[model samples]
Target: MDRIISLFSSSALLLFILVVQNTSSVYGNAEGDALYALKKQLKDPNNVLQSWDPTLVNPCTWYHVTCNNYNSVTRVELGNAGLSGQLVSQLGQLSNLQYLEMYGNNITGIIPNAIGNLTNLVSLDLYLNRLHGRIPTALGNLQKLRYLRLNNNILTGTIPFSLTTITTLQVLDVSSNRLRGYVPRNGSFAFFTPRSFANNPNLEFPPDAPVAPAPAPLSS
Candidate 1:
């Protein structure tokens, strides 16, 4: 009777484990779709994006794409790949993204406001691209961002004071752009140097105050 009871308990435990495993859900290719959207828009001269297959249920297998243990995309290292074309808004869907390194490309167009949605971002390096337009105020939304470089682009606009709120920020380079107005020298901006704001001939400096101090972060 003891032996029979032990076998029944083992069976029940096994059944429960199976049920849990079967119910476990994947991120469901949402990441894949987002990546494919980028692939469709980018002009990959190096065939770098050739491995990006939309048919796969996940984007982890794609080259230059890094995923965490959870199989969620965490980094996209595509610097100096000779990629062209504008960035897609789908990139904002990568909630777990930590590094977005797309510098030294010929990419053009405005930095999408959707990029502000990447709350988990630690590095946002879009420098040395042919990108134009105003640096989005939405970029200040990255509370976790530490490295923010938008230099060597054709971007035009005042430095968004909202960036001052990023206490985690350690490096900032907005030089060599067509920027105007005054730079924000408050909050985290206190740590930056003249080089960070250099090359923007039209930008006013050593100014009175920022358009506004960094405000409280909004809910993601």
Candidate 2:
């Protein structure tokens, strides 16, 4: 009887330990998965993320990662790093992300429209990268945006009219690309100078483009 009781006690202790470990592991993996998707999208040249080993445990201990009080990602700063890769749509899963600073890299790819799901995003700095593609119209959904810099890219397309809906935008830079078309007449464009749209071989700033003729009235 004594031997059976001892065996049962040991088994119960082991199970308790496993339950706690599994709970912690589950939360850690959730955070890791979010970042794993981001790393997979971008091409990293310097192997900066080599140490982001989820197997080793919490991402809060990794470099260039910042988490909030609830252990959710808040800021992702990879500035000046020799990284390259596409911005994957999986990044949208980081709904609590407030700032994503990825400056000075060879990264190339279209900005994923799924990024619009980051409703809490405040600053998105993708400047000084080799990224090419039309800025996603979904970015206009970021109502809290304060600074947007997509300059010095090979992007070719008209700026989406949806961007005008962002009433909070203050600094908008889309210069040095292949963009063309009359700049939108609202939001920051209402009084922006030629500098904001400079160096585009095909663009015609507002007032430069001739007005379209009004539609003729139809017979009753």
Candidate 3:
């Protein structure tokens, strides 16, 4: 009876260990699936993201993927990888993400509004792509953003007023796009040069095209 009881206890302990292991594996796989879904949304030019296999079980181990000590994804640096395709809204699922770089790709399509969900983002570099559409107003919600580069894309429309709300912004370059309108005269926009605002025909300038000052109050 002693032998049987001991064996049963050992088996139960082993089962518990297996359950914990499976749970960790599941967590990793779920995150991996989210990435895989993103991969499907993008068009991988030159097959660069071919190695982004969800079956790897842990995206943290994948190239360009950085993880926190807790093994959760913290950054994704796929810059100059030649990826293409529209950014899907699911990218917002990376709750802890701080940096995302996908520059120098042929990716086309509008910047997803869901990117505004990455409130913890510190740097976002999507330059030199074929992406079109207006910059999402939701982006102004990224309070932690420091470096934002969206140059050399096909983006159109006026800059969102919410963008001026990113007071934490240190480096912003929306140059070389189709953007047009009155550039905000505060924050980073105050210092931007004609070069930064070049290439767009409809963009109004300061001093040269000063906004007609608000009509002065009528004499009392």
Best by TM-score: 1
- Give candidate 3 regions above 4 Å deviation: 1-27, 206-220
- TM-score to true structure, per model: 0.84, 0.78, 0.79
Scanning candidate 1 in windows of ten residues, the lowest lDDT window is 19-28
* Superposition TM-score, candidate 3 onto the true structure: 0.79
Q: Which residue runs does candidate 1 get wrong by more than 4 Å?
A: 1-28, 207-220
- Is 1 or 3 the stronger prediction by TM-score? 1
Top candidate, metric lDDT: 1
What TM-score does prediction 2 earn?
Answer: 0.78
Q: Report lDDT (CA) for all predictions.
A: 0.90, 0.81, 0.82
Considering only N, C-alpha and C atoms within 3 Å, which residue pairs clash in candidate 1?
none
Q: lDDT tens string, model 3, 1-220?
A: 9999999999999999999889978877776777788889887647766778887867887778888986777898888887777777877877778998988888888888989998999998999998899999999989899888899998899988787778888788888898887777777556555555667777676565444445688998
* RMSD in Å for all candidates: 8.6, 9.7, 8.0
lDDT of 1: 0.90
Clashes of 3: 1
Q: Would you list the rank order by TM-score, best first?
A: 1, 3, 2
